[model samples]
Target: MFIQKKYIINPHFMYMAGQFDRNAKLCTIVTELNRTFIVDKSPLEILNDSIRCIGFDLRGAMETAKFLLGNKYMCPIMVNPIHKICVFPDKSSIHNDVKWFNPVHIARTFSSNQQAMIEFTNGLIITVPMKLYSFNHKLQTADQFRKMMLSIEQDPFSFEKDPRKGA
Candidate 1:
């Protein structure tokens, strides 16, 4: 119902896709915990801005994820590790039809005809144009990525160097 000029991807943001309608071309469809709105920017634009807001750019986020997930395609991006807002794209990021989803808020995904259906924790259901098996694989990867990040951060031995940087 509401059209926003810009948006940041946060914990409340469930998923965002580039939707084409009469009023807008490839506008971002942002679904949050409390509501869904339309953003004038494209999905990638929103993602880039969101990551930059937290002191990094989209390429940096993707490259870090790719490095950690070597040989794994469709890597899940950890936008804000402290906030636990990680997301994975359905298609390649260069594709205009890509849809980014945060698996944390996803209740479940099931097959519907030749596509997949995602049920959000907030009871929002949307069909994705992807095979059930493929969708599930991506979801599992995102889960794994999130777990790995949390484990590394929460490790008991994690500590900064005691001595001064120059010393």
Candidate 2:
């Protein structure tokens, strides 16, 4: 059984959820942020069964949408789908690609700081503050999250009994 989980992902940072299809080994992430020009969507199927990394230019989300429409790919069901494009320029030099990795190999950095890092099995690391993670039940601090994830590293099925009570 797949246990659904919810995460806040930070107030400013967009809420992103990734869905992976093991048979095809593909991942599709749908994200929603406060950026003016960005449109939030549900998981995209076009992004699946593709390469390890899929890059996107927010400025071109419209174009991407058109491409998906033309190809008969379903449009993602977004929470707040309508928004203005950001007028402020993005200066980050990072490529906007959605990379897929096995969840079993994912690990987190042990830190007391507000920010936390998740190291993927492929060695790709993404950092977000601890407050971003939302819980359906009890909350966990950054330190506690580190410990919980560490325990999972030791036994992946440890949480099978009760996912709400982290190992």
Candidate 3:
């Protein structure tokens, strides 16, 4: 007889809380494991600060996400050539009439990750597993993944931020 252990991890309420907070003014990305980066912020400062703090270029991430999402908008990812960073308002907070892109593509891409979770600009949570690239089954009860994400989000220096200033 084979015993399959059930993995149960609680979702991080802080992420959900931050998503609903309209006055949040900062965002940060912390790497918990080898290739995972957890995005957390007040939804106001996430776009800009994540680029500054995380080594991965925001332009690349945005372009990747945009391309993956199949956004019809031709707007370049970076408005400022020098800064190479885009600071647009969180799309999730906008009214339905203002939304121009489909998040299904983005969500699908996230669902393809080997082990990943993406908190969209609109507060949607997407969780992906390593073996999911071939099998696209959506795992709704991912407690360990949520716990790992929350752990990284709460720790500022998990990704190597300055310990003195406190990220």
Candidate 4:
């Protein structure tokens, strides 16, 4: 029987609890099971931390901090510029099911479709839907994508959302 290597680590799982750095060519993924894995970035020179290049739901740092602060939670949050990823402090007691996979991969999209594909080092191909975040399937180079990701800033929320908006 030929056993195909299935992904123990999915994209959504990586998004919530992991970080990526294109310059360094690394992705640090944390599984829900509280396991940490560092992988390489290759083939996917077209994929980086660009909002326009790939589909993602991201919370800007300032916005995240405001909400977290309002909740009276004391924790350290930092952004690794080199990695272009937001790093939040992990509380040991919190358990999750996150895992790791080979980071070296290729990302491509069809000119006529709003979807993309990510091919992993293990030859596993993942189809990435691009319309969720309103990305129109525009082709973006690694540098362009990095620039966009770096340029994103969290807009300040109004009093309606944060009671202590100014305070």
lDDT: the better of candidates 2 and 3:
3
> What does candidate 3's lDDT look like per residue over 110-155, in tens digits?
5333555554444555453335432232222122222333454577
Worst 10 residues of 3 by lDDT: 4-13
Query: By TM-score, how accurate is candidate 1?
Result: 0.87
- Give per-residue CA lDDT, model 2, range 1-167, as digits (tens): 22222221222233233344544433335332322122122223322211112233332543433342232222221111122111110111122333211222334444335554555444555654443232101112222333443555578776443434342
How many angstroms is residue 126 displaced in model 1 relative to the true structure, after the best TM-score fit? 1.2
Task: Give the winner by lDDT: 1 or 4.
Answer: 1
Clashing pairs in 2: 8-134, 9-132, 10-132, 36-84, 37-84, 37-85, 37-86
Q: Could you tell me how far off, in angstroms, the CA of residue 63 lies in candidate 1 after the best superposition?
A: 0.8
Candidate 1, residues 1-167, lDDT tens digits: the string is 89999998888999988887696487888889889899989988998898898899988988877766665777998888889889999998877768899999999999879899999999999999989999999999999988877876798367333354321
Regions more than 4 Å wrong, model 1: 21-25, 156-167
Model 2 alpha-carbon drift over 4 Å, by segment = 1-41, 44-102, 131-167
For all predictions, the C-alpha RMSD in Å is: 5.8, 18.8, 17.4, 14.3
Which 10-residue window of candidate 2 scores lowest in summed lDDT?
84-93
After TM-score superposition, the amount by which residue 108's alpha carbon in candidate 1 deviates from its true location, in angstroms, is: 1.1
